[model samples]
Target: MIDEQKQQDSMNNEPNQDQQTESSESLEKETAAATPQETEVVAEQDSVPEVETQSVSEDDNSQQQSTDTTSTEELQAEIQNLKQKLEQEAQQRETVTAQAKRLAADFENFRRRSEAQKEEIKQNEKRETLTKILEIVDNFERARSQIKPETEGEKNIHKSYQGLYKQLVESLKSLGVSKMRPEGEPFDPYYHEAMMREPSNEYPEGTVIEELRAGYMIGDSVLRHAMVKVAAAPESSGEEENGESEKNNSEEELA
Candidate 1:
């Protein structure tokens, strides 16, 4: 009976021992799963400090680039200012040069006008003096034509006057004075004044038949006009003359 009682106690103790072992195994598995989670959380916390330090470094670099950009902008502004100043100076110089050229051109034109005016005054004075001298020559010619030598002494005096007149004419001719003789030449209204129109067969129509008074010229300008007679168209025949007589008689009868 004591042996049977010891066997029953041993069985009950065996069941208690088995249950304690299962409980200890479950606690060990829970500790193992919690260990990996703690290690992961520690790794994330350590990486946070490194990320913050990198962000601070990037901010510093950006500030330095901003300072460099400010300096470059200032330099560009200064260069632009200098360029504008040079352009203004060049424009001012061009304006001054143009004004100087205009002044010089105006002065040159004034000088030319003054010279032309002086030359015109000189020509007018010369023409006035020459006209007075030509009047004196005309009087001398009239006196010579009216003079007659009847005695030997008067003949010598006339000859001496003729020599003086010839010398005067030569002097005037040397000074560009020239006499015009329109006789037997084509009539020029500018140089010749027609005193009468005479019908003639000896000369052509519109011809200067005779010069009653002398003409004179200096260069290409007429100084005096020649008093002249122009030739008219000749009568065709005796029949035309008789017709003109008959017409004149009819006109007289009407009168």
Candidate 2:
């Protein structure tokens, strides 16, 4: 009985060993297959990361190029705008300069005309005052010719009057006033007014024989015209005798 029990125990122990060996062999085969699958997954992951990195680098390069082109275009546009402004400013400056020149010329012409007008007015006033003073001088000359002194007191008064007249004539000479002597000169309507016509053998026709009124001059202009007698052609003696005979015949017819 002891031998049979020992045999049974040995048989059971042999089956247990065989089962363990088979299970160990199957586990080893499964482990070998799982190892290759895990290695392929790891390789795919690494390849995906490399592709993503290459795409990101390309995008960065394109963005940098676009930024550079935009900056250059903006700089060109700004330069064009500045150039147009400069041209406009230059034209405006020229127009303003021309207007200023015209205004200055007009003002200069106005100033000259104003000065000429003022001088003309002053000359007219001076001429009027001098003409009135000449009338007073004419009165003095008339008095001297009309009055004659007989007594000593009258002679002294006449002498004093003559002295005053001489002093007045000197003053007039200093003031550019002068008397004209038109006698024995040709009669001119500009300087002489013919008061009478006289037939004279001593003077030629159209000649001034005598001056009735004195003339005066201020500078080169005539202040007063001289009253003069112009010489004419003398009548012949035969014409005078014929005029006397006609007068006698008219008297006889009346009688």
Q: List, residue by residue over 120-157, the lDDT tens digit for candidate 1.
A: 79877877887788777778788888987799999999
lDDT string for model 2 (9-98, tens) is: 999899999999999988898879787997889999989989999999889989898888999999999999999999899999999999
For residue 218, model 1's alpha carbon misses the true position, in angstroms, by 2.2
> What's the lDDT for all of these models?
0.83, 0.83
Name the 10 consecutive residues with the lowest summed lDDT in model 1.
246-255
Q: How high is each candidate's TM-score?
A: 0.61, 0.61
* Model 2 worst lDDT window (10 residues): 246-255
TM-score for candidate 2, please give it: 0.61
